[model samples]
Target: MKKAVLILSIICMIFIFVQSWFLSLGGSYFDFATMFQGGIVGKILALLFIAGGIAIMFKPQVAMVVYFLGGAAGVLASMFIEYQDLFLWGIVALVLGLMSYLFNREEKEGKPGSNL
Candidate 1:
């Protein structure tokens, strides 16, 4: 389960880049400006998602908080940008949150460095 969520997180980040490329080429069905404005907050949130996914590998507990925060930001972004249906964005957040919740388990050793 942990591995699965890690994979999904990677996929989501890739999709974000792909979607940006699609908009650049004017090949997407949705409006780019409304969703991909490259605003300060959006970029920060994007970075947060990437960072959260990376951190998940080393520390699942801390990663869960990052994932939850990222999911919340995504949902908020959906509300501000209505180019695509909010339901889809909500689903993405829901999946991230669910996966994080399902896969999180305490490491046997303290903080991965105490003892065997």
Candidate 2:
């Protein structure tokens, strides 16, 4: 179950990058005002949430907080962005990160002489 969430979270991140890449290419670098004027905002928010999901690999406990905050931010961002998928992806990351954290805690508790 944890692995499933982790994989899904990765896919979300990949999709976000792909979408953002294409959106970014549509504009010129010289058009500074338009760089972050639209969909890019949601992409940035999604990236932050994905980053939190990745953190679960190194620090499950810390990632818990990040995921919570990221999820909230994504929900807030969804209010004004056309890419509502950001909210979906953020919720996914939050669930996955929490699942990973719980799994890690269970594993540690099940082990002998372990301190979590």
Candidate 3:
């Protein structure tokens, strides 16, 4: 479960970052802009998700909340933006966050001295 979350999180971060880069003024790929389309809002949210993804390696539960929130923000951001896999990745992020949350909870509870 952790591995799955880690891989997906990395993919999400990279996709967001790369897409953002390709859309920036310095970039020239007009076709790529439609892939994610969130403007500055998307970029900021992407940074948040990136930070959450990195933090998850050390702290699963807390980072997962951040991850989930980032996903939700993406979904909300979609109201104004367009495309971006038709918001498919946002839902994926939500599911990934939920899975990690539940998995970490179970792992913590199953431990010898866990109180959960």
Candidate 4:
């Protein structure tokens, strides 16, 4: 489960980075102005996702917080930019964040052997 979450985080971050890059390059599928203007926020969000993914590797607890915050930001940014795809990424980030929190909690509680 931890591995799955980690992989998902990495993949999502990569997608976000690529999307940000595309937007920065003036590539648009629907609304160009929205994407271009939102690209700055998108770049920041991408960095957060990348940081969260890296943190997940060394510190699951910290990564949990990062993911949660990043997810919330992603959702809000998506709404502001009127981009639907970012909402999905936000959902994924939230789920993975919750999973990481649960796993960390379990480890702290000493309920299991702790794979994370």
Candidate 5:
């Protein structure tokens, strides 16, 4: 579980960072146009998800909430964009959520006052 969580989290972070690079590269051949069409607010939200991914690497607790929100936002945003593999985004989100849940579950199990 830990290995899965680590690998997925790293991928999310890498994706986020790569997005910023894509932004600098004029976003040709990439699906940046649709996201930009979402306006400044949407861009900001997307950036938040990227930031959240980075934070997750350092702070799993906060990352869990961020991941949940990011996933929800992605699902909603997908309705407006024409991405090729949007379903994969949802699956990634599901994987992240499950990983975080499993990791937390084990942590709680070892603590005296845990709710698990």
Candidate 6:
């Protein structure tokens, strides 16, 4: 489960980065500018997500906060922007974020009897 979340995070981050870059280059392949409210903000969000992905790979506990916030922000942003596609991705991110948080919590608490 942890592996799956990690993979999903990485994939999502890559997609965000590429999409942002495309927007930066004046490419409207995904209409992210309209979805994000502007090209600059979209690029910034992508950069932040890239950072969040790196944090998830290294410090997952800390990254959990980022994931939750990002997920919520993505959902809200999508809705307000009226972008159905982003809303779906937002849902995906939210689920992956929750899974990652749960996996990290389990790791921290450890399995029963493991101390023995």
Candidate achieving the largest TM-score: 4
Candidate 6: the clashing residue pairs are none
Which pairs of residues have clashing backbones in candidate 1? none
What TM-score would you give candidate 6 relative to the actual structure?
0.66
lDDT of 4 by residue, 6-74 (tens): 677678777877777777567355557777756666677677777777777778888899889878977
Task: List the global CA lDDT of all models.
Answer: 0.58, 0.65, 0.67, 0.75, 0.56, 0.62
Per-residue lDDT tens digits for candidate 5, residues 1-116, read 54556666567655644553454344444547764443332344445555555655566666567667666766676677644233345456656765676677676688997763
**lDDT measured at residue 103 in model 3 versus the true structure, 0 to 100:** 77
**lDDT-sorted candidate list, best first:** 4, 3, 2, 6, 1, 5
**Candidate 4 global TM-score:** 0.78
Residue 41 accuracy (lDDT) in model 1: 37
Candidate 3 lDDT over residue span 30-103, tens digit each: 54453335555457666766666666677788777877887787787777565354156567668777876887
TM-scores of the candidates in the order shown: 0.62, 0.66, 0.73, 0.78, 0.59, 0.66
Off by over 4 Å in 3: 26-37, 83-86
Tens-digit lDDT track of model 1 for 5-110 = 6677677766655554444345234545664443333445446556667776777666677767766766676677632433343356456666665556445443
Cα deviation of 47 in candidate 5 (Å)? 5.0
Taking every candidate in turn, the Cα RMSD to the unseen true structure, in Å, is 5.1, 4.0, 3.8, 4.1, 4.6, 4.3
Tell me model 2's lDDT, rounded to 2 decimals: 0.65
- Choose 2 or 6, whichever is better by lDDT: 2
Among all windows of 10 consecutive residues in model 3, the one with the lowest summed lDDT is 25-34
Worst 10 residues of 1 by lDDT: 82-91
Please report how far candidate 2 places residue 34 from its true position, in Å.
Answer: 9.6
Model 1 CA deviation exceeding 4 Å by range: 24-46, 83-90, 106-116
Q: Which stretch of 10 consecutive residues in model 2 shows the poorest summed lDDT?
A: 30-39
